[model samples]
Target: MEVKIMEGGPNDPACPLMVDSSQVTQISEGDERDVVQSLVEIIERIGSYGDYRRTQRKECFNLVRRMKLLAPLLEEVGEMERPLPEEAIACFCKLKKAFMSAKKLLRTCHDGSKIYLALESESVAGRFHSVNEKLNFALDDMPYELLGISDEVKEQVELMCLQLRRSKRRTDTQDIELAMDTMVVFSKKDDRNADSAILERLANKLELHTVPELRAESIVVRKLIKERSGQNSETTQQIIDLLNKFKKIAGIEENQGYGIDNVFLPKSLEKSPSLLIPNDFLCPITLEIMTDPVIIATGQTYERSSIQKWLESGHRTCPKTRLTLSHLSLAPNYALRNLISLWCEKYNVELPKKENTSLGSEGSSEHKEEISAVVRDLSSHLEAQRAAVIKIRLLSKENPDNRVLIAREGAIPHLIGLLSYPESKIQENAVTSLLNLSLDEGNKRLIAKAEAIPAIIEVLRRGSMEARENSAAALFSLSTVDENKVTIGSLNGIPPLVDLLREGTIRGKKDAATALFNLSLNQANKLRAVKTGAIPPLLQLLQDKNLGMVDEALSILSLLAMIPEGHGVIGQQSFIQTLVELIKEGTPKNKECAVALLLDLGLTNSFHILAALQFGVYEHLIELVQSGNNRAQRKASSLLQHMSKCEQVP
Candidate 1:
């Protein structure tokens, strides 16, 4: 069948007959044909719906070319032979006539009287232009009203306009799918504005669902919400409803992961007035909403009522893990600490600074004023600072500045009270305070006078890293005076400190090493550490991946290994074996430390001699002897000489 462009009326012998069955199937079959027809019609209209209101002549030539391109495909779909080359000229001529006729009719704005003329005419392109111009003009304002028309009439007219514009744009299948999806999602929203203009414009280029239909869906959901929203238990029911809707959606992933708010609300509400709970309870640090608010040590749900109990214990949550904080998990800046700081500031409080000490010369006048100003402020806020100080006393470790303060004349008794607080930060802080106070001769005598050593040592045995480190530092400080050294050694601090050497964190390990180092300065503490299995861990730590830790451990081990018992410990265990391996395999600095330690340990045992010889520790020592680092050469030579002497010692 030949494709025909409608002219004026049914009188034209060239009047085209659309394959009625094909057109009907394309319209209602709701398959790919519907998609194709809908798309083709939209494109044709956008292409041919020329602007007629312009006084200047605008080109509708592109629209003609577009219609000509789609005419062949429409013909092919009707199972007609492809239009002959001659049919193109006839189609163009007929289209031009119809559009011109439509343009003339639109001039009257006669209530779509022009549309009826355009549809009825077979030979007049004037009718086509009239309908196109009016739609383009009307759609330029309100589009939604046009979309709300009856589907039957809309689909038929839309198919004709779209077929003409289809050739204007070569839209891809993906573009069509995206356009469909965008229409589906956006058209469902409540839009009450001049949507007619948009819908009319879209009718020219898109298949947006009617705005009225969208509003109807919203009305349905709103009715449902009205019927259900009055119940007191509605929020929980709403969650269930939302989840059910989610589950009903086809192809939703089965494992969507847990919902944070849904799981936590019941227990959280049971424990506290729900009003006190923020609608969104999120951790400030993590920024995600909180779940499973566990209480540490107290075994209670963390809620408004339990928050005070946690604060009293000087603990806060793990910033990363979102777990209930204990001494083991507390962050550096506990929320309570900030709370206390805010409390101090609110009441006009100031924190104390360390004692004003000049580095070299006597105080300048400017420095003196600064110091005096600080002291005055500290005095004014002393109560608040003391409160903060009291809180710090509860920790198992003392921050360095706090340690310095406790060494002053009056910080001990207040620190002692926190040992019973059960919070490790408090206990640690108490230990730190004791450490500081022990450093001063007067305070040391006072601590001994108060018999604080036993209590301090008890914490050393069971306290957190902060507590142990501070206690160790304190024990070191106390032993600076002879009586205190004997006092500390007698309290069984060596075994615990060494135990910490094996199990402590890097900082804890460092503290343990330093503590042993301090104790080694006193001969009894040196023997005690060597007797308490400190050598192997210290030796192991000397090979630590952390260079600074390695240096500190080696220095401590080097100091302790000078003692006879220390020498025996190093030789008897694989301490010497590990060191010999380190010397053979380690960097020059490590080799130097290992060899120096071996020399100090005297290389007496058969295991020490055999391992050192088997591992070629002597060869590395010789290489070190040739190096320019005088320290390495000296230590290496000393090690070789010691190995020579070990042969005679046994």
Candidate 2:
């Protein structure tokens, strides 16, 4: 239809101009002279029907009702004397009612559908469906004349018809998009007849005939709702009234323990979308997600790792309220450990421990039957020879290469799911599973696709020391992929890793060092770390009391210093001092790391070489070369030869 663009009145709320209905009906009936002109007017003024219907709901409904009531009255007057004016008014009223009602019903269905979802009860679901059926029936009653107004309107109508027909003719992907478009149309304001007809048609197409209320839109909603918090306002009230039933379900509640206050977000981490875990809810240890939810004897749940990490970090007061969390009466519920154990027992192909007896009670026939059933189930699915680890070990003795490092890919997703459980053991298992799975690129891609990176990164920040350690290893493997590197950078992995290195346990320190070592392999990542002021913490690692950790730290630093640009960023006072200290007091491994770092730095500039010579690096290296373990002696020889070459080149 030709839509006319008309100027809005000064008082109009920046809306499109609306066309008068009488002129349009007159043009539609039999007159072709003003049809194009009237169509242009309507098209020009076609303010989004969706927006107008939303703000003017009550006004629109009242207008439509008056027009419907006046239709017969005007027609009767037209039969009497001088009825042209009355006839015009009657036609105008009928046309207004048709278009206005269509828009109003569309809005009602959209909002009502959202409420129906929160109801969730079967009886209430039936009631909502009944209302839906009525709406659909009403839509079907709309006059086909409205759609046939002009060729332009005809085009839109025909398109809708073709889509509806195509959807029925085949099981193609286009049907999904068409279904989605139908939802959008239903969301708009439409007259009762149009609204009900679309609903009925969509219901049939979607096999929603039983209860048409659950249109395609509701299906999408149900998929998004992971868990039911049970407490919903609108639909819950409607359903309770209909079914006369009351029930309680978990909803958003304050997370006790860590003192961080809540904030709002588009989606929630919890099942209830309303709950907001504060942005600043840093775990005290790794300063990330609370690895375990701790329930004290007093019946309260707090983030376990967060509270512990805070205490270990020497934060006497809570970050939120500044209350002394350490003194708060509390104990670890071992929630994580228990959950992890259960999952491992059920799904783990490789049992961490051996069972000494039958899985069930002895002697009773029932017990024997159950045990036999369990064994049979295991044998049918899992390889019988490998179902039991003891059996696998016997086979491995004869065939060495047959042993596999991982049990299954689901192991990671399963472990990752455990992170949602309120247990540390589950989190630990998840971290271990991720670490073990990272042994291959295929597994890494799968984990990445599952959106495990962000969750794993979050866990590392909030998980237990062991969790944090394992997470670092997993992230290190993930960083090898370019996409994961960007993900790691986005989640602010540098500061957390630096914090872990500075304050973590021996294992945490080692993992953090290794993670950073892997991270340094990427120039962009190394630059990001350097830019984030991580050089000091990383440099401090060169002097780690643990030889293995020192070696790993020095190795990453050596790699970073190898590039001319990398040397400019990493070759600073902090790095030089740490290297000098390692040269003076480090073990053989530490010495090798320091030497590797120096060579990379000197390759860019002789400045690091001259500094090393001044710091007695040459003497330590010569002594090691002259006498020591073969590995240490070889490293010492390697360092001296490089230094001698540097001198000769100058």
Candidate 3:
């Protein structure tokens, strides 16, 4: 069979190629000659320099490069002198589509500059790259027996595809080199003295150059000193003298200037005899180290007590930055507090503990009495109970210690009882208080043991949005305990959570997703969640632009995918493409979850392997295998291997 390129002007009626019904019908009638000739003509047209010169030069270059590689494989099929199989005919149709799309894109480019610009556009480049990959696969992935091609022709096509891949890799390498060259030029012009100084300090602190030699000498000196001490004091002194002489001879400095003396010595022993504190670690109002640091809306940290006093005095501006306070809420600076504590521990200094208002100075009895007073007020008439609930919520918000105190005062029972009240506001406040109190593990157990799950579930199902949000939050906190997971799941918790996920506001959706995430940790709950229609809402949540929500949604879906029935349901949705997108564009945690979900689906059903490939997951998984973290790499590798086995089975 042979094909000839059609010669015609750009304005000719049939200027561009077309794959019509008659051509397919001809191939189906066992007319191998017509099919092969048509394919050859298309290949010739793709490679002709005269035809390419009339279109965009750059687009034509790429299209020709791809078509040139594919031409030989198609020609090999033509040389087989047999009718095209159904699969081969399908492959040809895809090739024709690629050809037509590329031609149309090229024809739209008006001039040389437009051609260059269009080729440089990422979207255009990506589309062309995808087309090329598809063509490569169409030729390389066909089964030889189905195509009636001899082994020699199959080997030739495979080798040509392999060479094309190597060429593509070289192009990628060149691109990386260009990027690195640009970055190097910018880096050389940038100021980086501070970064260099920090690196130098880190090197000195680690003793990267001197520690090994010091360790070697210290071992010998310690042994000699120990052996001589038993003989006599004089001999021990002589041994120490010998060690000092050896140290001098070896040019070992007595102090390596680690600053340990300054760090370890008490303030009384220091030469300056004053305590030193980092400026960032002290509150501006008192000029004292912050014990309970909190950040205001202006992004300045202050000791909570000092800031409270300032706010109470009607100062509505930050002391350091002098910015107006937009809101009165203070978020705890936990990371800063941790750093301060670590600094104190390194220098053997005691950190002063900050006391909460709810705790007494003396002991547990005084604390118990204070908590009892609050709870008593909460159990009173409506106004007083509301005030007490607000007070307890505020106290619980201050610190975990207050929460422990409130829980010990039997506040869980009272809070749960308030959930059944007629007033929605009171129910919301009660649940909010419970949410805060449940942060303590002990309180979680106590709340669950007090049969608070039923009331929380009731609030979740029937209360206002705020109440439902808080109830879900409390359930999430409680479900952190393994036993409480079963308790919540058994009390018909899955359906309400799904409802919240489906119809709630953004915040409500996040809270519901979080609760479902925790509940899905239990295997029984995962199965129950599937039966309760959890996957559809979870899939909806997966599209959220919030990374946290997407992460939580993917996590719950991954767990649900472990169930066989759940796998079938998830696979039914057009979710594989979304999962693949996440793999390419999501955060590290999101990618990890996405990869796990895909791997689970692939393992559960062999048919899913083909779906994964159709969604272009292989490239992402291969990239993960090369560059992802340990767990992601492991799962991606396993999935790839599984897909490979599925392909080989037939």
Candidate maximizing lDDT: 3
Q: Which of 1 and 3 is ahead in TM-score?
A: 3
Q: Which ten contiguous residues of candidate 1 have the minimum total lDDT?
A: 246-255
Candidate 3's error at 71, in angstroms? 61
Model 2 lDDT per residue over 522-553, tens place: 66777777666566666666555643455555
**lDDT computed for candidate 1:** 0.46
Consecutive 10-residue window with the lowest summed lDDT within model 2: 243-252
What is the TM-score ranking, best to worst?
A: 3, 1, 2
Candidate 2 whole-model C-alpha lDDT, 0 to 1: 0.45
lDDT of 1 by residue, 498-579 (tens): 8878988765665566556656667777787777777778777765666355545666676676666766666654666677
Q: By TM-score, is 1 or 2 better?
A: 1
Query: Backbone clashes per model, in order?
Result: 58, 36, 0
CA lDDT of 88 in candidate 2? 38
Question: Which digits, one per residue and each the tens of the lDDT, describe model 3 over residues 516-596?
Answer: 876887989989999999999888877867524776677678768878878989986389888888899888767877887
Off by more than 4 A, model 1: 1-409, 436-442, 585-588, 603-607, 642-650
Global lDDT of each model?
Answer: 0.46, 0.45, 0.64
* Count: clashes, candidate 2: 36
- What is the lDDT for 642 in model 3? 79
